[model samples]
Target: LAKTTQPISMDSYEGQEVNITCSHNNIATNDYITWYQQFPSQGPRFIIQGYKTKVTNEVASLFIPADRKSSTLSLPRVSLSDTAVYYCLVGEVGDMRFGAGTRLTVKP
Candidate 1:
């Protein structure tokens, strides 16, 4: 499994967009960039993922650079209820490990 490094925190106001980028220069060939969003006491929820290019769903958009060394998760129109921790992990589902994540503060 490849290790990922990203921000420890980010701040934004309600109705604003937030984009978080992660760097994994040592990302493995079989590894995938996955983003998770965690509310205070709850477990993280899958936000988006991609090995390359872009992927967008109901919640957010994932943008992976061509080199595969970095990726970004874009949240459209965040709200105070969106305050949470965001994590970027690189690896297979079962092979991944959780670490202290970036705490995101969405102000009203």
Candidate 2:
């Protein structure tokens, strides 16, 4: 996966919105940006993905700018249960690396 970086934590109250951003300037053309959500002691779950522009699913929305160097994951009306680690990975699913992820904190 293309290398990426994001904030270590974000504070949010219950019923509020949260947005996490990631940066991967070295991303390749064939690489796709994918975001994952992981609660403590659990594996990361696929949230959203996009090559460019915006892609929205039932869980979250992914927005990738035209440059493709950065992406954002937007969660609407978050709750305390939503507090979890969010990861941004770039590349195919099979091509992944083990790295430290950003730990998100949601407040109630």
Candidate 3:
């Protein structure tokens, strides 16, 4: 199992960019880093993913270093609606596991 680590919480204001980082010291060569956003009572929502370097989508951008030991999820111009728990999973598609996650609170 690929264990992950992340900040317990983060605070941001509306219209600001928020970057949350996750660390996985033992990430395997075939492992993929995927991020998810979840609201209070909702399931996790896929945001962005990357195996290495960087990957960007309409929602966010995921950046991974060449070493692949860590990754950052960057959310641009976030709003209050973006306030949620962000999860980082490491490993293959169906074998991925979630850490505690980073609770992001976007203030107006």
User: What are the models' TM-scores?
Assistant: 0.93, 0.91, 0.95
Q: Positional deviation of 61 in candidate 3, in angstroms?
A: 0.3
Q: Residue 72, candidate 1: how far off, in angstroms?
A: 0.5
Considering lDDT, where higher is better, how would the candidates rank from best to worst?
A: 3, 1, 2
What value does the lDDT take at residue 91 in candidate 1? Answer: 91
- Candidate 1 per-residue C-alpha lDDT over 47-100 given as tens digits, one digit per residue, 9 for 90 to 100: 888889999999999999889999999999999998999899989877776666
In candidate 1, stretches whose alpha carbon ends up further than 4 angstroms from where it belongs are: none
* Residue pairs whose backbone atoms clash in candidate 2: none
Candidate RMSDs in order:
1.1, 1.4, 1.0
How many residue pairs clash in each candidate at the backbone level?
0, 0, 0
Q: Which 10 consecutive residues of model 3 have the lowest summed lDDT?
A: 91-100
lDDT of 3 by residue, 30-74 (tens): 888989999998999888878999999999999999999999999
Best by lDDT: 3
Model 2 stretches with alpha carbons more than 4 Å out: none
User: Which of candidates 2 and 3 reaches a greater lDDT?
Assistant: 3
